[model samples]
Each structure stands twice: as C-alpha cells, then as structure tokens.
Target chain A: MNHKDKQIQSAVQRALGDKGLSRRDFLRLSGGGALLAGAATSGLLYPGTARAVSTNARIVIVGAGAAGLSCATRLNRELEGAQITLIDRREDHYYQPGLTLVATGVWNTAKTLDSNRRYVPSGVNWIHDMVAEYDPDNNRVITDDGRTVEYDYLMVTTGLQVNYDQVEGMSEELIGQRGVGCVYDKPELAERTWRAVDEFVDNGGVGLFTRPRGDIKCAGAPLKVTMLTESRMKERGTRDKAEMHYLPPGASLFSQPDADDFLSKNFPERGIQIHWDHPLTAIDPDAKTATFDTPLGDETLDYDFIHVVPPMSAPDSLRESELAAQEAPFKGWLEVDRHTLQHNRYANVFGAGDINGVPIGKTAASVKSQVPVAVENMIQAIQGRENSASYDGYTSCPLITELGKAILVEFDYDLKMKPSFPVISPYEEHWVPWVMKDRLLLAAYRAMLRGRI
Target chain B: MAFSFVGILAVVLEFFRGWFWLLIPLIVLDLVLLGLFFKRTSGRRRKFSLPFKASIGFGVFTFVMALITLPGITRSSWEMLAGAVDYLSLIGASVGFGVLFAILAFPVMLHMLGIGPKHKPESQATRQSPAPETETGAEAEPSTASQQPQG
Candidate 1:
C-alpha cells in the first residue's frame, strides 16, 4: 500500500474512533478504569479522613476477623491514649473470601491461612479469648475465661457462626468424606471440600451445590463453586458425564436483581438445573442424599458430591444478649441503625462485619465499606458528637460464570447497580471482571484488611 | 487470600500446576515475532502489512491467553530486583491484550455500531500519493491534476 492508502486508512481509523467512542464515553471509561486500577494496585481509595482523636476511653472490638482487625487497626492508629483491645481466640486469620478459589482448585489452602498477629496493630491489646457474653447495659463484656472487660465504646465485629448441625446428620468431620464439602468454615475445610470436588470432577457424577436460607458470608461463593466445578468438568472433558444442580434457598440465585436475572437465564443454558426455593435442610452423607425444604414439601435429591452451605447467624451469646434485635426479620442479628451501624438502644455499642443486621453485603468488601462507617461513628461517639459516617449497605460480587469470565455485580441498599467500571457491562460476562476476581480483588482485600482501603 | 509473600509464592506455584505453563511459550514466541515485525516496519507504515498484521493478530490472541494467567505475576513479586521482572511481565502481557483490543476488537465493534470504514475507495488508494504536510488542500488538488498530464 502507498502513502495515499495509508492516509485513507488513518482517516478511516480516526473517523471510526471518533464516532464509535465519543469524548464522554472515553472519559467515563478511562475514569472508571483509573479508579478500579487505583483501588486494585495502590489501595488509595480508602474513603476515610483519619485524624488521631486523643482520649482515654476504653475501646473493645470483638473478633479478629477482617472486620474486627480493620476496625482495631483504624481505631488504634486514629486514637491517642485510648485502650483498644481486640478479643478473639483465633491465631490464624482465615481469608474467608479466598475459600471458593481454594475449593475450586484455583488457590491452595495456605493462601487462606494468615496470622492475625500481623494485622492486630502495635498499640492495641490482643485478648486471645472469645466474648462469651456482651453486657452492654453495664458497659462490659465477659470473656469465655470469666474476665469482665469494661469498655467506653464496644465494637461487635464477632462475625458470624456457621450452624453445620442445623443440617441433620452433618458435622465438621463429615467434610471431605462421603463426598461432603463445605467452604464456609476454615482453610482446612475448604481444602477438604476440594478433595471431594476433585474426585467428583474426575469421576463424573451428580454434583449438588446448595445454599441455606437467610444470610451467608460471601454470598457468591456457592455460585462460584458451582461454576468452577462445571468449568473443571468442561476442561476435563467430563461435562458430558456429570450432572450439576444449584439449589439456592430462594427464587432468585442472587440478591442483586440484574445478577439474579442473569444467573436465572445463564444457569439453564449451561445445563445446570436450578431448583427454586429449595433450601437445603439436611444432608445424609452416608446415604449420598440431600433433603431440601421446598415450598410444596420436602424434596430429596441424590448426589455423588455435595457442597453444603449451612445457615449462618450472629453467635448465640450476642443473639441471646441485649445487643441482638428483638424484632422480626433481623432477629438474632446485632441490632444497629443500618446507616450509622450504632446500636439502636445503646449509642456506645457498634457492629461491624457479618454480625451487623444490614440487609445485604456480609462480604469482605462490605467489611471494607462498613468498617469506615463504624470506625468514624465510634470516633464521633468518643468525641461526644452524633454519628456522622453512614454505611450504604454496599456489596460487591465478582460473579464468575466460567474460569475466564465474570460479571462484577456491585450494588447498595436499593439494589441498584453501581458499577465501578463503566466499560465493563454489569449484565454481561467479561474477562476484565474475571481478572478482577482472580488477580486484583485479593490485593484489594488485603489492602482493606490493613485498613488501607 | 493472605497476600503475604509466602501465600503469593504458593499462588504462583499453584498456577504452574494448571495450563498456565502453555501460555509462557505462546507469549515468548509472540513477543519475539512482534519485536521483529515492529523493527522492520518502524521506518514507514501502512494499514496492511501481512506479516505485521498477522503478528499483531496472533500476538493479541496469545497476549489475551497470557493475560488470563496474570494471577501468577500479580500475586507474587520479587523485592530483590526491585520488582523489575514483576513490572516487565505485567507491562508485556497487558500491552499484548491492549493491541488485540485496538486492532481487532475495535474494528469489529465500530462496524457493529455503523461507524467503521466499509468502502474500499480504490480511487483514493490507487491514485497519486497524498501531498506533504506543508501543502494545502487547494494546492494538492491542482498539483494532482497537473501531475496527471505529466505522468
């Protein structure tokens, strides 16, 4: 081609670029990419204006999980002369968000196990014991060892408990045996689940992935496990021999409406059966069966491999205490103003992480967003001021549809989509979202754990 | 996950256990091909050079495949070399994916939106070469006409 042809081609390219991507679209996409990239790489979008508030107040944060550690880190750094104590017996902090990756064979179990000592901050006191009782009335909490620790302000970041016994004939020991798998607990449990998943993938058979009724941490994990198992089967050329069933506890596969609709349509297309409103009530591992409490009646399904997600709730101690909500729906959950994250009746008490009674987002991402609110409000309380920071119930799920594609579904209290990337369509499966999940989100999660984001 | 140095190391090792190993050669070969093509094409350029275009097209494909293997590079980085290997790997893989988008994906996308070039316009391409930057449009038109008789 001569120079004239090159000129025409250049003109055509320019025209195409100019018309196809207008300045507005270009700027929006560029800006969104920059924000996500910034959040992913530098951990700069922390959304907090931290200033050390000098006080002699006693600050107690329960649990040493993501939320607890984050709050403790922020409080320890931003408060002066404050006696900050974090109470939790856990030494190894399990990165719960990565459990799905471990179970799906993408990540090793070691990837999930982290030492809590690394994140507990220097100035804060670490109480290696569980809070057996929360006595907000007396402004004190009793530890399992019978120590009554008083606090000027209490942060209940105890996370939640997995009720494996709620599913009849199921126990923690049953995982990795009899084709039973549960990814909600420890790193070992997720690794054990992988053993069952690996065998099922090799020897093609009935694979049942079930989610229980009510809230669960990292709600998208069950879906990811199912999809990744399917991906593995496809990769191994065993998809033809295996049958997969996803038993979500409700009519919708996910809480976000668009994501729910997408999953509803996408699941059947991939030959995975969706049993609507079929919450897993029990599983007899020895018999290789799962019983679901359908709206019509009890329905039993035979499975060679099953991923069990048990019903979750705030620990019994908190639920039985005054801190829990006494009303309907959010009963047994930490009763707090959803926006302020402060205890409804007690201003000194606050809730973070999975224990909070927020409508959605019991995720690491939620903890990242909520910790700022809870910390800011607690600081405000220390300053004898009204709560200023508010949590918007922000939750994000990188909903992986395949090994290489995902839809990043992010939303708030209203369930309206709030996409960080303007170019990546929230409704469609794309590699960028998958990259975000497989690579970048973990970095962001780590950053958030350190209170950097 | 932990995102600690050890956990990152495990993730990188975890990648090698899968098909990620195949992407290594695909990407190495792609870069080599791209490097040679660009070296030859740097002096003058046109819309189509079969070798350069094909290199870019396959380079895009290999680059995308390499990109999918990014979790390995992203998770773990060496501090000894001051992240030299880490950054180079990331930049190389990302650029490959970027080229695929710019050349192949954009054209198809633009065409779908009815903005991409469709006409061949043989007259424009086969006629005398475009005038230099110094020449005005008015002068170029008459020069083309006058040169037609001379040629």
Candidate 2:
C-alpha cells in the first residue's frame, strides 16, 4: 500500500474507533442511505413523472418567483414545442422561507439570495420586466416597459406584495431604525431586522410583533419571529427584561385547528402576551409607538422593538386588472378556482402561489403542490380535455419555536393536520423539523423549481 | 400515503434528497477510498467483509454530516451554554441526517465499488489465472456467469 493510502485507512480506523461506531452502526447507516436513494428514485418521496405532452401553445408566466419559476420548469419539461415566457423584473431570486431564519440571526443573508437565471430552464423566454397590466379579457399582458405579450395560456404566479403604506406613518425605509423590523422577502431587510432583534435581545424592553388583518404569505413567520426573539432573550438571560406582545388581527393564532390550539397555549406559557382583534393601524417609528385598531377602540402602545408584518394583497397590476375577484372574501385577488387553480371567467388563465384567493396555503410548500395541478390543468385545457389534477391546498410550515426546535405543521384547505411523517407529531416541537428548515428546505425548494420533486 | 414503514422511510429519504449534491460526491469518494483499501489488502485477507467496508464508509459520512450540521445547531453563542435543547438538536439532526444519507449512499456505493456480483470475460479469466478461479474476487462473481463468462 502507498503511504498516503495507509495513512487514510489509519485515520478512518481511528475516527471509527474514537466514536465507538460499531459495524452495526455502519451497516445501519449504509442501509439507510441506500434506502433513501432508493425511495426517492422509486417515486415514494414524491409523485412519479409523467410523459411530456407536445404542443405549440404560447405560455406566458407572470412573476419569476417560486411559483412562476416552478411552473416554467414544469411546463417547459411537460410540453414539447411550447413557447414559454417568464416575466419579472427582479433578477435576484429570494428564498422567502429562509428570511425568517435570517431575521432571527440563524442564517446568513447570502443563504437566501439566488439568481433567477440559474432556475429558468433553457428554451424558455424570460422577459426582464414586470407586468404592469393583466388584460385577461384580451388574453394579453402589458409589461412595465411597454411590451404587450399575448399568450394562448396565462399562468398568474405574481406573489402577494406587502403594503407597508397601509400602516400610516410606516414605510420600508423605517425598518432597522428605531427598533422597527419587518421580516419579509428581502435578505437585506431580514439582516437589518436581525440587527434590530440583536439589540432588542441584549437590551430588552417592550417588544411588539404585529400581524395585519388580511391574508399574508407564511402566516407563521410573524409568530416564529416572536417566539425566536423570546428564545433569544431567554438564551441571553434577558427574558425577564423584555415584555413581548403578539397582536393578531383575529382570535385564532393559526389556520389549522390543532396548530392553533397548540400555539394558543404555547405563546401564553412562554409569557408572550396575545391581544386579539388588534390589527396594526399605524406605527410612529420616531416616537417608538404603534397604533392598533381594536374592537374596543384605537389603542397606541409604546415599544422598544417591533416586528411589523404589513397587510398583503395581490400586486396592484393583478388586483386592478379585470382578472381580480370582485366578490367578497377573496376580493382584489386573482379570481381562480381554488381546487383547479384555473380562472373562473377565463379558461386560458390560471393562478398559483400567494395570488390565488385560496382559503389557505400562501406558502412555498403550497407552490410545490399547486404548480403541478395548475400546470397539469393548463396542459389539459390546451389538449381540449377535462382537468386531470386538483390542488387540496396542501401547505407546510416548519414553525420554528426556538433555534433548535420547530413544529412541522402541514395541512390542507380543511385545516386538518396532514403530517407527512406520522412519527413526528404535528403539534409538538421537534428538532427534525428545525433541521429541515435550517439545512434541508432550500434544497427541496430548488428541486421544486427544477420540477424534480 | 398511509402511516406505513415504507411511507415513513420514503419521507425520510425525500428529506435527504435535498442534500444529494453534497452527499453523492461524499459517498463516491468514500467508495473510491474503500476500493483502494480493499485492493491493497486483498491478498492478505481471505475475504474483505462487505459489512465492515459499509461500516467504514457510513462512519466517515456520519462524522462529516455531523460536523456540517453541528455549526447550525449551535450557531448562537448563547445556545452553547443555554440548555439541553441545542445539544439534543445536534444529536437528533446528526443521527437523522446520517441515517438518511447512509441509506441513500449505500446502493450508490455498492454500484460504484462493484461489491456485488460481477461478470468477467472468459478470455480475460483464462489469461489472468491458469487454474480454476478460487479467489475472493472469483467468489464475488455469479457461479453461473463464471462457467460461461462470455455468455
């Protein structure tokens, strides 16, 4: 044997011995790795691949975000000879899921930043401009740069926009200043939020985490930021010094009943107070006070640190367009059937991601499930056949309770717990879910974008 | 998917698919190293046990995965001295990742290392050995295939 080979063998032997990793352990690990690869390949991890259909249909996808890119990849792969164009002005793709981690100082800012160019498949046209107007009636979209692109089929994946202006006296510029933090999609903003959280953790005082009235993407993020901040306070031996308040717009803490039940009790036990029906009306960043419009009356509370989650809705382009739902409940959102994800009025139009007026599932996990159904339904429409796939509004949230623990909350439109791994209870906190969130989810998300399950 | 063993196993497998880029390469490297080790020690030992080889590969993988995931589990300085949550998370994540990756890499390792049944051409077998094949390498081959290697 060569000296180098002998040395490597010797080092490996020493490591095994030091760790007391027996032959059984090795056998188990090897068998386990083999099982994982086998299971993943055998269509157990996700659904099986279907044969690609051929079509010359012009498909224009709005917004190159998670849902848009995923739809592009899926549609590009599934349909042959199709003209697929993705429209979005933003070049930098943000992993919105990791923003919560970054805001909590658990992840670096760079981890959430990626390029859309990397995910946009070849043979697909990418328009480097945002859609200024969605004219579904004419089956055409006008870009911000004055380009009108007509499509045989339209997929609206323009994710919801945070309205910082909704809260009077509050703006995106105010974040990271005067102890105001907003954990949204921006990595820089998340980092700035982390700086504010860090200062709040060290010098503790009244920390208020606010949730707006309307539906927001990743509803768990605000609660997660609150819990994590409190955890950080406890870790820093400053838990007693901080007075944490979670002001939700409604009585329920979460959408799912079991999750809501668990969180409703969990927050109070953590000593973080909850004020129901208190929607954030305004925030005076200079005065360090937040105004909440409560059922009783308008109440202003002073704060040392505030996590501002703005009221969200479909982008102005989509909302102002004729495509938006004019009805009650889902008004100002993309008007699409919740199950089929196809437009109610326009058969050529489909919606996925947060823009859909679904009762639940404004999450990346929902995108994972919704994109396929939407793409399949679009393909079915192009084939002049009935829709074959339907979305159950499946969404997952790795609700981080602390740095080390989280709850794997998975549910559908019915708000019932559909735990993927039945062994891990959906209500209890566990490290497995936390690890999935911190280390593994980005890979899964990227895989989704590539349409590889 | 119901709550069956296979379903749970699949979930665990899907979880590790995210880390496949890093893991596949790691497993391949380990297999290459092990192949070299087996090649060097082949003559001395009567048989290089597959279980032992698998153990060595898995050990290395688990150690590396633990190292990679540990920093995240204990990223905060306060988490170091805070309580049992950080340490417990480290242990759980290490074991979970280790097992999942090991399961995913074992088949890959077996395929790359050619540890299972292999076919050798009759002409090559005749050229390499004069007498009937009696070595460990010969035993690893299919008996039926050995009789008619070319076929």
Residue-wise C-alpha lDDT for candidate 2, range A16-80, written one tens digit per residue:
78999875787798899997777557755444444478889999999999999989888887888
Cα-lDDT of candidate 1 = 0.79
Q: Least accurate stretch of 10 residues (summed lDDT) in model 2 chain A?
A: A42-51
> What lDDT would each prediction earn against the true structure?
0.79, 0.83
Error of 2 at A354 (Å): 0.4
Name the regions of candidate 2 deviating beyond 4 angstroms: A1-51, B1-151
- Provide DockQ values for all models, in the order shown: 0.05, 0.10
The residue pairs that clash in candidate 2, if any, are A32-B103, A33-B102, A33-B103, A33-B104, A33-B105, A34-B103, A34-B104, A35-B103
- List model 2 lDDT by residue over B56-131, tens digit each: 5795689666856575544533232233544565666577667766665554445455344333465576744333
List A-chain TM-scores for all predictions: 0.88, 0.89
Model 1 CAPRI quality: incorrect
Q: What is the DockQ of candidate 1?
A: 0.05
Error of 2 at A351 (Å): 0.6
Off by over 4 Å in 1: A1-51, B1-93, B96-151
What is candidate 1's lDDT per residue for A1-453, written digit by digit as tens?
A: 999999997886687597897656767888998976664433332323354789999999999999999898788778889999999998998888888888988889877788898777887899999999988889999999999999999999999999998999889999999999998879899999999999999997899999999889999999999998998898789999999999988888888888988888888999999988899988887789999999899999999999999999889999999999998779999999999999999999998989998899899878988998999999999999988998888888888777766787889999988776555568776655666677666666666666766
